[model samples]
Target: MIKSLLIANRGEIACRIIRTARAMGVRTVAVYADADAKALHVRMADDAVHIGQSPAAESYLVGERIIAAAKQTGAEAIHPGYGFLSENAAFAQAVIDAGLVWVGPKPASINAMGLKDAAKALMAEAGVPVTPGYMGEDQSDERLKAEADAIGYPVLIKAVAGGGGKGMRKVDAEGDFLSSLESCRREARASFGNDVVLIEKFILSPRHIEVQVFGDSQGNVVHLFERDCSLQRRHQKVIEEAPAPGMNEATREAICAAAVKAAQAVNYEGAGTIEFIADASEGLRADRTWFMEMNTRLQVEHPVTEEITGVDLVEWQLRVASGEPIPLRQEELSIDGHAMEVRLYAEDPASGFLPSTGRLDRLAFGDATRIETGVEEGGQVSPFYDPMIAKVVCHGEDREAAIDALIDSLADTEVWPVRTNAGFLVRALDAEDFRKADLDTSFIERHGDDLIPSGEADDAIWSVAAQIAAGDDQDELVGFRLNAPARHAVWLSHRGEGRLIDLAEAEAIAFEDDGDLLSAVDTTATAYADGDRVVVFSDGVGYAFDTAVRGSGQGSAADGAIFAPMPGKVIAVDVAEGDSVAEGQRLLVLEAMKMEHAMTAPFAGTVKSLTVAAGQQVEVESLLVEIEPDEG
Candidate 1:
């Protein structure tokens, strides 16, 4: 087996690869950004190297820096843990030329699937079923639209270089095709540095099923079953499970065999995933599947595959990289049970899934199956990286039990500082359609609200908030007197409304006025006192309300003004001198953390004032737009 390895990635994935390297008696090296200096992966690695600045372009994407780190650390092999340089063909070649084993597929394999347009062409020639559409390089808008029209309306306008849903759009009508195409191209250029795009037939209701395949130097390849990644929002996968629901034995075998053939076609080695979009609208079968793309390294949802097979895939990677024969033959491998994974992100689902950042005051999730995270209690959820805090994976004897276990585990998690999808996940598990496996890529969009919990914090818990707001008793800690019932007015905010609750009773208290039900619209609020510290849960997050009651006052109209949703540079301004605008009009675009977010007007008004310009960095909640009443 390989004696040592260098993981050219950061966060949970780097840590994950290092774990497998350690288990296999292989030394590990970690390359990090300045922001990841305190990351768990660095702390756990046998040795560490600082690659470059925090930004990916300056650091992780710097193939030279990564290769140098591996050479200096004496690591014989480099493992590109998904994202960053994992699928970069040049990077793979660089590692090999540096006299280090690239613990992944060959550079040829990476190039074969680097561009979606090219990959689709290769798949078609290899007898793999592919979605019918235009993969031509002719970027002429007229030519592209012509292709879309011929392929039929409702085709997908996707950037050939797209990932993370950045540069992809669905056009249901010819009139909307050009604008959506422009948006996709612009986003693709900004996000991936390539404006190349392709049009594909848009499946009305498709389930994303990908087969994980492994190959070694000995010309052997085997498939590790399939994972259903249909549960997604905005083209980003949120939940994934193995052994797709309602998949018959014959269908599963055919898909797995096709995945193996695809891998062998590229002479692929190490861990790779072949994603296929299936027409699950009619139910999963052998005939209704088409090629999507391939991820040529360890995937984010690898845990579920691990749980069912009871095999350490990382160990297999290292062994295969060392030129060992394939670990287990195709017939010898069989999945034991069911496994599911939920990606927990530190983003506000209510506000268009905007990224949230701050100190992680507390993060306590129960130990059900496995929850992989890099943040500690005092750590920070920086906008410098992915807002995802962790991935929770659960395993059980069957799918139903696995899902039930996932629900229980998500409920046990307690995250602070940023809004999360915890409540939404809980609601999703109880949903009828989800229970029946009636899912697709558009499942979240079709039933988004069903997954978002209606403010349902325990009523008993709210009774306490009402009491505290009503000042039933004075705090014995700060304002306490043995004489009169200590009545006090405290300001509090939850969901979208703020209020003052005044109470005088010592033991029991209630809201002073239940005029406007704050809890009804806002998130359910939870309040608890453990000795002197107070813990509160709202908006799918648990927080320490230290001085929450003391600083419970509303800000001026300035506070009501629109603020930057994230820490990004302004890209465009929609308003000029005294322009009238309607509610939800895009006022400006802020580019931060590699994604562009538009700040919109909260209500119909005239542009009273605007601040900042394109290419200026603004912190979260920094005012970006101001509006006034439109008397005209």
Candidate 2:
């Protein structure tokens, strides 16, 4: 095995690799940007090195800096954990040329699958079933529109070099094809530096199923079953499970076989995933499943596959990189039990899932089966990286048991000040369609109204907050003989709305603090209190309330002022000063955390002030534009 390894990544994935390397007695080196100086991954590694500034472009994406850091620390191998340089073939070759083992697939395999158009062509030549699409090298708009017409309506326009849901657009009719193509091309050029695209027939009911495959330097390959990632939002996966809920033995065998064939065609090494798009308008039929693309490194959801296969995939990556054969053959591997994983992100579902960033004043996940996180209680959720805080994973004897356990685990989640999608995930898991396994890529979009929380604190939650506010005083007043009124009022404010609750009328509430989380004794409600602020958690949603006495005053609206929702760079400014616009006209676009958000006019008006322009970085709540409403 390799003696010392350097992880060229950050967050939970880096920490995960450190765990396995340490258990195997291999020393680990971690590289961090300025923002991650006190990060959990840096603390966990045997040695740490500062690369550059906070932004990824200046730090993590600089391959030469990473290679130099590895040499400075005398690392024998470099493991690019998933995101930063994991799929960069040039970086992989550079590491190997520098005499350090690259714990990933060969650079040749990465180059072969780097672009979707060429990869699909290769898959077809290798006798693998690929989706019907246009992958030709004609970069003319006329050719793309003509191909879309030939493929039929509802075709998917995807960037040739895209992943993580960027640079992809779905057009439902001919009239929208040109505009959607333009938008897709612009985003593609901005994100991947490649605006070329391909067209494919969109499946009406698509289910994303991917098989985990491993290979060795000795030309041996094996698969570790499949995972169902049908639950998605904005083309990004929110939840994933192993051994797909409704997959039969025949479909399983066929999909797994094709995955092995695809891996062998590339002479793959280490861990890789073969993703397939299944048309589930019927069920999971082998003929309906087609190759989507290949992820040339470890995946974010690899933990669920590990749970069901009893395998440590990171350990396998290390051993294979050291010239060992794959640990198991295809026939020797089998699924053990059901497992599920949910990504806990620092985003607010009520605000259209905008990323939330701040110091994690109080963060706790109680008694979860397994948790993979990079931030602690006092760490910060910076705007410079992915907003995911942790990944919650659980295992059970069967699918039903797994779902039940996962629900319980999510209910115990407690976060405050920085909002999260925990409540949204809980509702998604407990939905009737999800529980019945009636899943698809449109699950969240179709059921969004029912899944998102109302952002209101109910009477039960307010009562719990009141109990905490009246702490110890209520206990002392028990059995008082003198002039104690039947009810005492407690003044509180929630979301800027004030209310007075009668302490005597409140239902008997109890609380217990277990050093990690504050829970209502004998109830499912959880709460946290710091000074005058209290946050009550129900169904994994935190509702913050102020305990100080205050008059009932409504909050003022922004009227015509548009503020930056989060810290981001202004990508486009469509309007100018004195420009007349309609109520919903596009004003500008902001890019943050690898996503674009368009700001629109709140009402019909003339632009009075335009303080921002393209390529300017703005902080949270900074004034960007102001509109003066049209005179009556």
Candidate 3:
């Protein structure tokens, strides 16, 4: 076995690898950027090394730096946890060339499946079922348009080297093809350094199903069943489950077999996943499923597969990298029960699910579920990396029971100040369609209204905030004077509404009071105050209210100034100082947490000032531009 290993990643996945390594009596080395010096993974590892600056391109993506760190720290192997340089074929070769064991598949395998266009042709030639589309090498825009026309309308323009929905676009008609292709290429270049693309027929009701396969140096490969990742938002997976809810024996066997065949065809080794896009319009038919792509490393949602199969996939990766054969034979592995995993992110569901960054303040989840996290209460959710807070996994005897457990777990979770998708996950799991196994890529969109919580905080919630502000004292009538009831009014702003409530000194705030005329508030609320800002937890959602004080907590920016919504680096400034802009025209693009957010003009105007330049790092609410309203 490899005596020591270095994890070339960050967050939960890095910590996960360290845990299994420790259990196996293998020393682990952790690498961190400047922003992650105090991160949980850094503290958990046996030894640590500083790589470079915070940005991944400057740090984690530097293959030579990682390899040198591993060698200097005496690590015998390097584990590139799922992102960054994990799927980079060159990085794998670098590790091997440096005499360090690469804790992933061979570089040849990664190169084989590196690009979607090339991989499709290879899979087809190897007898794997592939979707009908254009994977030609023509790089001309006119050729792409012709291919889309040939494939018919409603085709997908996808980055040839893309994952996690970064460089993918869906076009419903011919008129939208060029712009969509441009957007796809731009994102692809930004993400993968590749501008190549592929067009495919879009499956209207597609169910994303993937099989977890493992291979060893001994040429043994086996499948650990399948996972259903149908629930998605913004083309990214939101929830995943093992032993797909409505999967029958025949479909399961066929999909798993095809996955094994794909892996064997590549002569793959280590942990990998074969993702299939299943057309579920008529339910899961083996023939309707098409090969989408292969993930050359461990998946973010590997815990669900681990839960049902009673296996530790990370340990398998380590063992295989250390030259062990497949842990279990094909007959030995079978689905045991149902397991579901939901990705909990530090992002606001109300504000277009923008990444929420700040102090954790409060992060808690139930003990009944498995929680994989790398952050603590005082940890910061930086804009330099992914905004994921944790992964909550629950298992039960069956699908319904597993979902019930998952819902309960989500309801029990509490994250304050930094917003989260907890409430949304609960509502999604409780949706009738979800409970009935009616799932597809459009699940979230179909039930979006129910999932997005109302922004307005109710009277009861306001009362709870008031009580917390009043020190939670039930002995004295709040704000009451001896002569008369003291007129103490608390001003709060929530969801664009300013609420003013008067507190009577003679009446105590009761926790059990119903929302009647006198007690129109539910008092069983959790609240904490940060100076004048109070955050209350109610109905599985966190509501933050700013105390309406003069010169504080007002609307963002001046009348003509465009302020940064969150702390990020200005990647592109689209307007000049004297440029005229129309309403809703994008003025700049801010790159935060590896995602791009466009800042647009509120109304037609002329640029009065451009405060920040491209590549400048700004804080939340920092002014980026100032506009003067056009004189009519």
Highest lDDT scorer: 2
Candidate 1: tens digits of C-alpha lDDT, residues 1-632 = 78889999988888888887887788999998998888888999999999878888899889999999988989899988888888889889989998999889999998998889998898888888888899986789999999999999899988888888889999999999989999998899898899899999999889999999999998999998999999988888988998799999998988888888888889999999999999877789889888899999899999999998887888888888889977899888898899999998887665566677766656767556998887777787777777788998999999999988988787667675455777787777667888789899888889866677544334344445544343324453233236755446554444323444443332343223343222212333444443333455553444332223543345234423676654457888878748988888888898855677878887788887787777786654456777775555
Point out the higher-scoring one by lDDT: 1 or 2. 2
lDDT of 3 by residue, 418-479 (tens): 67888888889888999999999999998877898765677777777665554443334233
Evaluate model 3: give its lDDT: 0.84
Q: Which stretches of candidate 1 lie above 4 Å from their native place?
A: 137-142, 453-458, 464-533, 538-540, 543-632
Lowest-scoring 10 consecutive residues by lDDT in candidate 1?
512-521
Pull out the clashing pairs in model 3. Answer: 460-521, 477-505, 480-505
Q: Which stretches of candidate 3 lie over 4 Å from their true place?
A: 141-143, 476-525, 545-632
Predictions in order: lDDT: 0.78, 0.89, 0.84
Candidate with the larger lDDT of 1 and 3? 3
For model 2, the superposed segments whose C-alpha errors exceed 4 Å read 475-486, 510-518, 521-523, 549-632
